[model samples]
Target: MRSGGLKRLGLVSGLLAGALALSACSTVGGDQPQQAGQDGGQNASLATKLIMGTPNPPPLSEPVDTQIKRDCPPVDVLDGAAAFRAYATPGSADPFDIRYQASIADTARECSSLGVEAAIRVGVTGRVILGPKGSPGSFRLPLRIAVVDEKGVPVYSRMHPIDVTVPAGQTQADFPHIEDGVVVPIPANRFRGWKIMVGYDPSGATQTRASRAR
Candidate 1:
């Protein structure tokens, strides 16, 4: 009886030792620290393009839906908002924020080389959509549309304050903005390398004063 009891006690001790060793090996170190991601905080860049003159293509010849004609207009309406010439630094915003969204949907350029001047008429259209939290109200959208060279030097910049009126029970608005007769000098040649960049301008009188205090 004594010999049998000794054998059983030895077996139990060995099993406990093995279990403790396995636990120690699994958690050799404390909680592992999470490593930072490689990507720095960067927003997806806005769209850009070289302007080209192209008239609206001929409309579809066959359309027999009678209600479609009465319900929707054939073409989009454009507001007669003038684009100004100004220089202001671009600002960044959270893309995923449910505040507002604005973008330059289309641009067309008509280049002319008259007696001694080279100019172009740039047509810009911006669309605004209010998010879930946005309410119907009147707000001015500061659109910073500028032309930059290859080295990202601003050849021309204008802060067009677009007056947006979100109608009652509506969450979307569309308007066309134009900056006509923009003079693009030949000395700044490399026209293909030139880029038209458009983004929101977050600078204002209140913010300007606060920045100066700092």
Candidate 2:
């Protein structure tokens, strides 16, 4: 590669890194809804219709643009619950028994600010990497999307059951999940402190078949 090409590559990488640094919260992003707030089935584009792992949870769609919407809450991913690691063994760290690992790559949102209540649409994008013991097949990717006020008060939170499939001959792919119609009532003075949060929720993950190595 030429020096100019190298510089261009470096610049692109730097730009990408800088975008992910938008906040100390949200996007290592992954999750599940406990009680349904709104059925995303209609507006969910790639949830069950996508074509890529680095992009699917049975989820993930295209690469999400981290751009924020005006008059709307921003989407965020929790740092601690960013990635989901599944082991072939019940509770062992043996690398050979590793199944697959999934992570949140980006997030986006659209908020409705015209009425006394706000409706927000949140989307999460990510990928899955197959491990040594992992195979090309369907796997569960747990995720949780939550909402909170600016003061850190809980507004809406739920777990969403998401999954991704590893197609034949592919070691990995992309996934994108979008939840639509998250409505929150606006208070007096029109103070909007709502934020959409996304992350990996292991508690909602399906029980994996662990190896005897445990």
- The lDDT of each candidate is 0.39, 0.55
What's the lDDT of the predicted structure labeled candidate 1? 0.39
TM-scores of the models, in the given order? Answer: 0.47, 0.63
Best by lDDT: 2
Q: On residues 124-164, what C-alpha lDDT tens digit does candidate 1 reach at each position?
A: 44446675446677656666556666676877777666676
Runs in model 2 lying further than 4 Å from the true structure: 1-69, 189-193, 206-214
Q: What is the C-alpha RMSD of each candidate to the true structure, in Å?
A: 27.2, 11.7
lDDT of 2 by residue, 21-48 (tens): 1122333222222101134322222212
- The backbone clash count of each candidate, in order, is 0, 37
For model 1, the superposed segments whose C-alpha errors exceed 4 Å read 1-97, 188-192, 204-214
